[model samples]
Target: MNTTPLRLLIHGASGRMGQALQRLGSEADSGCDVVAAVSRKVDARVLEGIPQFAASELHGVPEFDVAIDFSLPQAFDAILGLCVARRVALVSGTTGLSDAQKAALDAASVLIPLSWASNFSLGVAVLHTLVERAAQALPGWDCDIVEAHHTRKLDAPSGTALTLGEAAQAGGAAPHYASLRAGDIVGEHLVQFTGMGERIELVHRASNRDIFARGALHAARRLHGRAPGRYRVADLL
Candidate 1:
């Protein structure tokens, strides 16, 4: 294993996933350093000694190996521009981007290594793979995806849920989605295939937010020093 630590920048350093990354990435075994962080409003207390800057202030920040973003979609363009300018790799988990915004990512991917995914949990990735196989084997079944998250989660049918639905579609099944927002549910996704008196369900539940934080860190390690290209969490798996 390469022991050289990766220099890291976080785009949404004040948010849930961002804080999680800061906590977990600080460990000596994580093989990375939280050199800097970016957010709309800089919060020194939350960020501790790590430097925090606003999106517009990124021009003055030092270069880092890779950036992990969990901020709003609106911040993506700015982050992409910064990453491209610095020749930095990027990993983004921001969801609900418009087609044009996604196009911007595609354009940037050509200049630097980038990985984008809706969910970073390894279990969720496995669940997606399993859903594809089950849907392929049960052609006659009706499929449905139900996902639940904390009430503060902005996007409905969490991006992971949609990805699961896409996997089902790829396997020749049309799936409907249901989204639920309740108190403090870390995350839960269930894909059900129902047929005549028989049903199969593939489920993944996240009890803590650290799973995503760890996954993003893993992707950042894979993205470091890689050639320019668009990548996905599935690729890491």
Candidate 2:
């Protein structure tokens, strides 16, 4: 096994997930080194030995093995382009992407190792697996997925819920979705399979945002020096 720490570039250093990555990556046993941090604005040139850069200075950062992105959709293109140009791996959890950006991601995957996901929580990845298995086991059952997030979340049905539906579809089940946005609920997903008299419910609830950052960091460590292709958090797990 490779003992060397993977070099990391943090792309959205000011956001919640980005800050969590920064804090967690600073730990001695993280198995990674954050070489550069990028945000829209930089008040400091360096923080705790990691060089910080404004988004405009992205081209000036030193080389890195993988980049972990949790920025907005508007900023997604630039980091992706940089990673492809540098021939390095990328792991992004940025959401609200348009069809064009997703197609661009598909195009770039052929040239570099990259993975983009809506949520980067390992529990959600395991939930996705369980959803597929349930769908496969209960043929002809009615499947419904209900997802609830904090009121701040804009997208209905949450991206993780949609992905779980896709997993159910792969197992020959059609799924219905319902979304709820309420106060301060981190995230909750319920996949229910109903039959004539009995039903099965699979649930996953996330109370902390740090899980996403931790999962993304874990993905970066696994992603470095791999074959070029798009991947899911489940694949890395």
Q: Which structure among the candidates has the greatest TM-score?
A: 1
Off by over 4 Å in 2: 1-3
Residues 81-102, model 1: lDDT tens digits: 8899989899999998889998
What pairs collide in candidate 2?
A: none
- Tell me, what's the RMSD of every candidate? 1.5, 1.9
Output the worst ten-in-a-row residue range by lDDT, candidate 2: 151-160
For residues 198-224, write the lDDT of model 2, one tens digit per residue: 999999999998888899999998888
lDDT of 1 at 106: 92
lDDT (Cα) of model 2:
0.91
Please provide TM-scores, in order, for all candidate models, with all chains considered together: 0.95, 0.91
In model 2, what is the error at residue 69, expressed in angstroms?
A: 0.8
Evaluate all candidate structures by whole-model CA lDDT and list the values in order. 0.89, 0.91
